[model samples]
Target: MTTALVPPLAACAPVGVFDSGVGGLSVLLEIRCQLPAERLIYVADSGHAPYGDKPPAYVQARAEHILAQLRRAGCKAVVVACNTVTGLSIQALRERHPDWPIVAIEPAVKPAVALTRSGIVGVLATRNTVASPGLARLIAAHAAGVRVLPQACPGWVERVERGELDGPETEAAVAQQVRPLLAVGADVLVLGCTHYPFLRPVIERVAGPSVIVLDPAPAVARELARRLAQAGLAAPGPAPGDVAFWTSGDLAQTQRVIALLWGQAVQPQRLPDDPA
Candidate 1:
């Protein structure tokens, strides 16, 4: 019989970040920028890319599985960097691990509501996030009487997953979703999905110079910093921490795209097969 060794949990343990795909790299970048001292462990569940279009139950299951893997890595805290999962599963996850420091992302609706000059804000997100009741509740809470248009960007996540940041087809797809919102006088566009940030230039070109695009990753990072301090899980440091990558997708392909998005080369390991 083989005994498995588990990493010891401590304030210095690496923070775990999970996303449906490379989109979560956007959030990871923010966390890295904000908390340079903390070691980071990131998982891109790319085999299940674009959780935005998946059913809530399916996304919830995948989220649970990935979180289990992160916990097994002995993460001090976990960040659900995928907005779709945050929308669909965050509450359940928090309930399941009440004492764990889990930070989740949501659309920047409150900020969009405040920033919209035309009182019309456009939210570009995954289908699942747009359809989730949590988004509706969020709009109701912060966007009262404001025209908060929820635009479900179907192909955006896949485009980013394939490392297609800019191209005619990508532009067309982004324009197809962005124009209508602009036509309707939405002066502020909120990137509700982490992957959407990679498409910001295209989105901005379609939206024109007058529009404001908001990414919530920076804010999420700040919130994470606060949470870690509150929980006394902040890493003590003078040295910059390193990042480890894992994926449940093709290792070579995942590594390539991650290098493209992350602006450097990184070798990503394949996730272990599910236990029997």
Candidate 2:
């Protein structure tokens, strides 16, 4: 009698990652690098791009739609890779899906406090993220005795979403945003929004070599790994896994953005605007 061979543990279903736009690609890239054996499914909700400026209720509704679609795709877990959504609606999502393993991003205030030699750290984030009470609580708890300066770049997210990495406009914007913080003796800058990392070069140019820039993607990935391991859902390693892309906006533009961000061509499948 012939026996059936079992598939390796690394070949499991993909983890789901979602963001308002292309910004989440930064987080997805980190997760892919850290957990190469695990597959990933990424959805860019570009139909509602730039969640940073949207109303809290609208952002929450969009998050719910995205999560439901991801759940239907058989995701092992979902990562709220956008800081705005994380700060605004993550608790609601957790309460609604208590058993689902969800990971959310927050500012790296704690880590920045630990690393800052000047005791002054600057945070560049969206309006929503900077104004969040969740972020306020985090600062109160972890950033004790550490001077924290928060700046909200009104159109920064939109510029990044449009694939504007470094240009005269971007450089000027960075300078305008970082100058005040630098003047106040900020030695470290926290990229509090996922999209902000894409403009790191501009920010670095403005802040100069004396300053250090921190992206929270790596820390977020580590937390994800810990949670997966604790839940006995970690993928066994050895081989690289596949990645599937989906978008709710222009597929061609989304594909280009994905390729630019990930260094790999992505042919994004279209999802219904009003997914039932």
How does each model score on TM-score? 0.95, 0.93
Clashes of each: 0, 0
Candidate RMSDs in Å, in order, are 3.3, 4.7
Error of 2 at 161 (Å): 1.5
For candidate 2, report its TM-score.
0.93
Tens-digit per-residue lDDT, 1-276, candidate 2: 212212334227678999988899889999998998888998888878888889999999999888878777777778999999988888899988887789998889999999999999998888988888778888999998999998888788778777888899889888888999999999999998888889998899899999999999998899889877777777776788889988887888888877888897878998645553
Q: In terms of TM-score, which candidate is strongest?
A: 1
Which candidate leads the pack in lDDT?
A: 1
User: Which parts of model 2 have CA positions greater than 4 angstroms off?
Assistant: 1-11, 272-276
Query: lDDT per prediction?
Result: 0.89, 0.85
Q: After superposition, how far is residue 175 of candidate 2 from its true place, in Å?
A: 1.2
